[model samples]
Target: MKVIVTDEISEKGLELLQKDPRIEMDVRLGLSKPELYEAIGAYDAIITRSGTQVDAELLSHATNLKMVARAGVGIDNVDVAAASEKGIIVVNAPFGNTNSAAEHTMAILLSLCRNVPGANSSLKSGEWQRAPFTGYELKHKTLGVIGLGKVGGRVARRARSFEMDVVVYDPYISEKRATDFGTRLVDLDELVQIADVITVHTPLNDETRDLITAEHFAKMKDGVLIVNCARGGIINEEAMLNALNSGKVVGAAFDVWSEEPPQGDVIRQLIEHPRMIVTPHLGANTFEAQTNVAVDVSKEILNLLDGRPVENAVNIPRFDPDLMAQMGPFMELARVLGDFISQLAPENPGKVSFQYNGKLAAYDCMPITVAGLAALLDRCTDQEVNMVNANLVADRRGLVVEQGRSTESEFFSNLITL
Candidate 1:
């Protein structure tokens, strides 16, 4: 097996791939488009960060490519559907940057509270300033976290250590789960009104776009400090600027922007605001994060080569020829059942049970189970969910998957239920 590294990864990661005698690895960074197009045809697998674009055009040239692994969480650079159609597996390291991102969120929040950027700029110009940089203490303050996923959960724990009260507004998580993390569960309206400092850690989508707008700012406590280390557009940029100008919000910190390396007049205005502290999306830039992601992606690549069940595959199923032929019509039916059930059920379903009856019970139903799960989950996440990683995705979401087979069905010869 041959693997190509299209981006710079930790040496430790390369060593792991080299350890396998059956694998041959190549490090080829900064390849021109034509060169990459040609080079990818010979390799069985490729690993990249965010630099390469694995689009349909490029995938067309990758005749021998079996898999593509991303060293980080996001797969925006990869055309997942195109890869999936070609039977190529796409995987990412979702856990690699959890700690680094959480720490960066804390760093941004602290910097905003103490006016660290302003203080540093003043001192560099040979001015002594002390009282102007007065900062708020974290103790006894209310910290509202929007999402309690990996990064947000870590931030919540850190806030508790600082003696700050933590409140969370995640519709997906239960109140008991929030309490387990030393945080209180509250609604969005309540969180916005009661929180002294607000941090957002949710994914950007149709629902979360402009999540915090002018009206939300109006509901916030006076002099509220806000931090967004998640995605951009979650906190409406125009609203944030207006709030900063009106003194409704004392200060705000942002790692991700509505537009990365934002160039528009509104983004420029926010950048020029003294009270707004920003970074060039540096939430996952730590050295540890890079190493962790590299090691993770490398292990996944090795798993693919070894025929092991990969955990983070972001594309469709790869079934044996005979299995695919036998499971054709059932796969379509299973997909419909998944889609229908998912829409009718709650947003974040914790458990999904599947029942197969009659002739279906006698044959291997694993493929059908996976197909249903993939269809159900494809709508919920940014990542592509497929039969290859359906159960893994369910497990990661803390969902219990139960399936049963029965020889009895009143109406149909084979009945599948969810």
Candidate 2:
């Protein structure tokens, strides 16, 4: 099997692939679109970050490609639907940079609170202005966390250690989880109104796109500090600017932007703003995170090649030859049943129930349930719905899923009713 690393991957992951006698690896960076199009057909697997776009056009040419691994969380750069239709597996390292991103968020938040950027520049310029560079303590301040997943959970723990009161608003996470993390669970409105510092750690989706808009800004406390280590556009740039100008937001730190390598008037203005601290999307830029993601995604690619179950596949089923053979036509029937049930469900289903009958009960029905859930929720959420987080993603949208089995069937030996 041949593998291509088109983007800069950690040397450690490359070494792993090199040591495998069954696989041949190539590092082909800085390839133009036409060059990638021409060469992709020869490789069986490809690994990339955000630079290379694996679209329908590219996948169409990649006749021999069996898998594409993204060494990071987002797959916005890949044409997932096309890859699925082509029977190509797509994998990503969703947990590789959890610590790195959480730490970066804390770093930026601290910098904003203490005016570190301003102080550093002033000292470098040979000015000793301690009064103007006065810092604020995090103790007793309310910290609002937008998303309470991996990174957000870490941030909440760290903030609590600093004696800061943490309030979280993640519809997906249970109130018990938030309480366990030493955070008070609150609604978006409450968080916005009371928090002294607000941090975002959610994916970019339709519901979250420009989530913190002008109206939201208007509701926030004056002099509230804002941090975004998640995707761009979660906080509306225009609204932030207006808030900054109007003295509603005292300081803001942004690592991601709505646009990469931001250009034109808005970006220029934001970067030049004295109260705003911006980095060029450095949330997952640490050496440790990069290497971890490389190794993680490489392992997933190898798993796919070896016909083993892939853990972080961004699609349903994961295309297991042995499992598919055993399941036979029942798999197809289950999927169709799931589809039928999902269509009859409400616009935002609160729960999904899957009942298995007869011989289907003998086989493990977890994969079937996941496939059904993915098919159902994919129609709702903007983010890619896959087996990895289908149930969790459903829970995020206030949906619950239950699966049951029985040894009774009417027509087929095994039956799946959703």
Candidate 3:
């Protein structure tokens, strides 16, 4: 199979793909939009970073493209919905940069607290100004961690080693998880009010975007420090600058920004501020991170070529590898049954439910349900409905989809009923 590398990746990763006898990999960088669209049709798979925009127009030209492998965690640049419609699998290395990001957070947080950057610049410029550069210690400080996922959890552990009290504010995490991490779970309002240092590690979405706004900052302790290494829009840039100016925030350490290559006055003012520490989104820029992400996506591509289930597909449902062979027959059966049932059912059957019976109910049944859903909705929608776009189409059509599992099945050893 032919694979193309449209963007730069670690040599280690390129070597891995090159060494595979069954695959032929090509690296073509700085290709214009028209050139990329034309050349993409020849490759079965593509490996790229954020530079390549895998959108609908490009995908339209990629007639033979099977997979899009992103070397990094974020898939924002890639139009996932568009890829899904074309039955192209999109994958990314989500865990490869966990340590790098967590470490960067600590680096900036320490640098901000100790005024390391300013002091280093001062001494290098031939001045030994010690008193002005002197800053506070992390010990005995209350650290409020927002979001206790992989990176945040690691940050909490590292902060504990510095003798800092770690408190978390993730509604999804269990109480047991908080206790296991040795961090107290608190509400967002409480965390902002009590934390001497606050760091955000949440995904930027409707709920989390502008999460730390002027209102939230107003509740913070005087001279409270802030750190954001996750995403750009999680914190309000305008409010952050105002806080820094008013001295309500002692300092802020940011690795990511609302706009990468940040523009305008609010972002510029934050970076130029005396007490703020900024890096140009370098959380995942470490040598090790680059190699790790490359290796991860390469291995996933190999898995797909071997007809194995993809672990990190953005648009596909993942099933346990061991159970895949056993589930394959049922999946096809599910789809055929859905097609047959839809023909008999009345018009506007408001809710469609997939019921898994017998031994199959013991494991994950979502994939089977999705397969059935695709066939059932195929005639109802204008689009070519498949497992990849079934859920999205169902939502758009205002159809309620549900699933159930039951161990008791008198008819057969395994069954997928809709």
Candidate 4:
């Protein structure tokens, strides 16, 4: 199997692929977008970090691409839904850089609080600026944590060590978990209003993008510090800039930007602002993180070539091999029925439901339902719909997907209804 490494990755991680006799690995850097698209047809898989934009356009050109391996945690650069529709599996190393990102978040927060850059610059320029660079102490301060996942959890622990009271806002986690982490569970509104320091650690998804807007900033206390070392656009960059200017936010540190390579006038002005500290997306820049992430994806690629289950797939779910065998043959049949339903239903057909009975209902019927959904979307939308992304596409289009199963069939030993 042939694999293309489009972005720069650690040599330590690529060694696994390099030594493998079954895999053909190529490092082709600085390929133009068109070049990448045109050349991708020959490769079975591609590996990337954050630099490459793996969207539908690129997937269309990758006629033979079976998989996409993201070397790091974020798949923000990769259009996962598109790849899934194309029958391409997407995987990522979600855990490899946990410490690196968490540490960076705290590092930037401290830098912002202490005016480290300005103080260092002043001292180097021959000046004593002890009073001007006076900073806030973490002790007794309320630290509000947003999305207490891997990185946020670590940051909270570190803040607790500083004697800072930590409040977490993660609806996904239980209040018990928050207490274990030395944090009190709070809502976004309460966190914003009370926290002396606020840090975001959520992924950049539809729900989280621009999560902390101008309204949230308005609710903040004066001189409240903010930090965003997670995904960009989560805190609303423009709103942050406005808050910095208006003194609604006394100091802010951001390691990631809405646009990488930090473009636009607002970002430039934010960078120039004395109260704001910025870094070029270096959240996962640690040597250990780079190697760990690379090794993770490399192992997955090897897993694919070795006929082992790719465990970290973002698009495809892990299923028992035996169960897949039962559902595999029905995919075509389910798809045909879905196609029929697509043509038979009205333009604004509200919701879709699937029923499985008898033998079919005995097994997990999710794959068959998804296959039908893919066909349903094939005619209704321009997106390339397949079993992998059918349910996702259905949800995004506001086409509710519902399913039911029964042990007995009305007329046949096994039956599927759409």
Candidate 5:
């Protein structure tokens, strides 16, 4: 199998790929759109970072492509829907940069609290200004962390070592998990009201977009320090500027911006502000993180080539071994029926009905129904829909789904209705 690394990947990962005799690898860096289109057809797998756009037009030319591996967490740069339609599996290394991002968050937070950047500038200018750069101690301070996932959990643990109180907000995580992390679970309002420092670590989605708006900022404690190492646009830029000016927020550090390479008026002001600490999206810039992500993506590509299942696959179904074989044939039939139904139905499907006929009716049909649901809605949903939560996605979209099975005899041994 042939694999192409179209962007800059770590040397460690490249070494592993080179040692694998079953795979042939190529590195094509900084290629133009036309150059990439011309070169992509020969490879079975393509590995990339944010620079490459895996869109419909590009996938059209990739006749031999089976998998696309992204070296980072976010899949925003790749057109996942387009790739899925062409039967391409997309995978990403979501956990590889967890430590790197958490470390960067702490780095920025510490720098802002201690006024490191200003002090460094003053010393370089041959000035001894110790009194002006007085820093605050992190001990006894309240650290509020949003989204208590991998990176957030790590930050909370590290903060506790400094004798700081950690509070977290994540509705999805269980109470047991938060207790295990030794963080006080609280609502967003309470966190804002009590926290001395606030840090965000949530993915950008419809519910989380502008999560920290004007009202939320108003609720924050006066002189609160804010940090965002997650996605841009989670905090409203205009509202943040207003809070900064009003003294509601004392200092801010942002590694990600709503518009990358920030160009607007508010972004320019934030970048120029002396009290604001900003980086060019370097949360995952550490060498260790890069190597981890590259190695993870490489392994995923190799797995796809060998016709084995991938653990971090973003577009494929994750199934149990015993059940996978039993339901394998039904999945194909479901896919064909789903495709046919979707084309024949209206622009928006209000409901989907699944009916099972013949001797196969005695078996549990929930998994089959979900598999069919995934196929029908795979091309429509923004997020990846698998058999695990296909029904939930359908429910979220206000689509009613019904399932029924019968033991009546039919021409075929089993029949599935949609």
Candidate 6:
């Protein structure tokens, strides 16, 4: 199998792929759209970073492509739905940069609070201006965190060590989880109102595009500090600038932006503001982060090539072929039953019990049950649900699931009830 590297990755990752006898590798960086399109047909797999755009047009030319691996968490650069339609697996290293990003958040927050960048610049330029750089400490401050996922959770823990009170706003997480993290869970409105320093760690989506707007800033404590290291659009750039100018927000630090390499006056004004600290999206730029992602994507590609299960596959499912064949007909029936039952039954179901009778009961019907659950959840989530993760997903949603089989039949040769 041939693999192409369209963007730069750690040399260690390339070596891992090279060590595999069945694979041949090529490194082709900085390819224009046309050139990349022309070069993709020869490779079975391709690994890329955010620099490469794996769009429909590029996928169309990739006749031989089996999988596209992203070296980092975000797959925004790749058209996942398009790849899914073409039966191509797209995977990303979601956990590889958790520490790096979390650390960067702390780094930026500290730098902004203390005016480290400004003071360093002044001293280097032969000036002693300590009075202008006076800043407050994190101790005894309330730190509000949004989207308590991997990076956000880590940030909360680190903030606790600095003697800061942490409040989290993540609807997805349970109260128990918040307690374990030593954070008090609150609604967005409450978090905004109470927090002395607020940092966002949510993905960019329609619901979160303008999450922190003028109104949100208006509700915040005077001279509240803000930090965003997750995505660009989660915080409104215009609203933040307004807050900064009015002294409602003392300082803001951001690693990502609404527009990378942003243009226009608003972005320029934010950059020029003395209280605002900006980095060139360097949250995941550490050497360890780069290597971790490289190793992760490399292992995922190797697993795919060797027909092994990939836990992080975003576009497809993995199933045992022998089991799939046996349960193929029952799988469809199970799905229909689940769909029909879900529509007729009450909302917010607590448990699902499956009973199989007749000759079909003699076979291992676990795969059939999984298929049914997948179909049931397919209606609820935008994610691709499959037999592998169906039960896992159900558990996460707090649904109880069980299955039983018997050779006895009531009316027909076989009976299945959900």
List, residue by residue over 224-249, the lDDT tens digit for candidate 1. Answer: 99999988899999999999999999
Please provide, for model 4 over 137-202, each residue's C-alpha lDDT reduced to its tens digit, 9 standing for 90 to 100. Answer: 889999999999999999999999989999999999999999999999999999999999999999
Q: Which ten residues in a row have the lowest lDDT in candidate 6?
A: 316-325
List model 5 lDDT by residue over 145-253, tens digit each.
9999889999999999889999999989888898899898999999999999999998887788899999989888899999999999999999999999898998999
Clashing residue pairs in candidate 4 (N, C-alpha, C atoms within 3 angstroms): none
Candidate 2 structure, TM-score to reference? 0.80
For TM-score, candidate 1 versus 4, the one ahead is: 4
Candidate 5 similarity to native, TM-score? 0.78
Overlapping backbone residue pairs in candidate 3 total 0
Candidate 2 regions with alpha-carbon error over 4 angstroms: 317-366, 369-418
Candidate number with greatest TM-score: 3
Order the candidates by lDDT, highest first. 3, 4, 1, 6, 5, 2
lDDT of 3: 0.90
* Residue runs of model 3 more than 4 Å from their true location after superposition: 319-353, 358-364, 374-385, 393-402, 410-414
Sliding window of 10 residues with minimal summed lDDT for model 5: 315-324
Per-residue C-alpha lDDT of model 3 across residues 304-417, encoded as one tens digit per residue:
889766778889875766778888788889889989987987777778988888988998888888888889988776667777788888887788998999999998987666
Which 10 successive residues of model 4 have the least lDDT summed? 317-326
Residues forming the 10-long window of minimal summed lDDT in candidate 1: 316-325
**Model 2: ten consecutive residues of lowest lDDT:** 316-325
Residue 267 displacement (Å), model 6: 2.3
Please write out the lDDT profile of model 6 over residues 1-418, one tens digit for every residue. Answer: 9999988899875678889898898999999999998999999999999889999999999888878999988777888877765557798998999999999999999999999999999999999889999998999999999999999999999999999999999989999999999999999999999999999998777688999999999999999999999988799999988999999999999988877777868878888898899998899998999999998988888888786556577765434556555556677898898878777766667898999999989887776787688788767666655554577668777889988989989788888789
TM-score, predicted candidate 3 vs. hidden true structure: 0.88
lDDT of 2 by residue, 1-418 (tens): 9999999888975676788899899999999999999999999999999889999999999989888999998777888878876667888898999999999999999998889999999999999989998878999999999999989999999999999999999999898999999999999999999999999989887789998999889999998999999998899998888888899999899998887878857867887899999898889999999989998987887787686567788765544556666764665566566667767777887778889999769777878787778777776767666555576677668887898998888887876777
What ranges in model 6 sit over 4 Å off? 317-418
Whole-model lDDT, model 2: 0.86
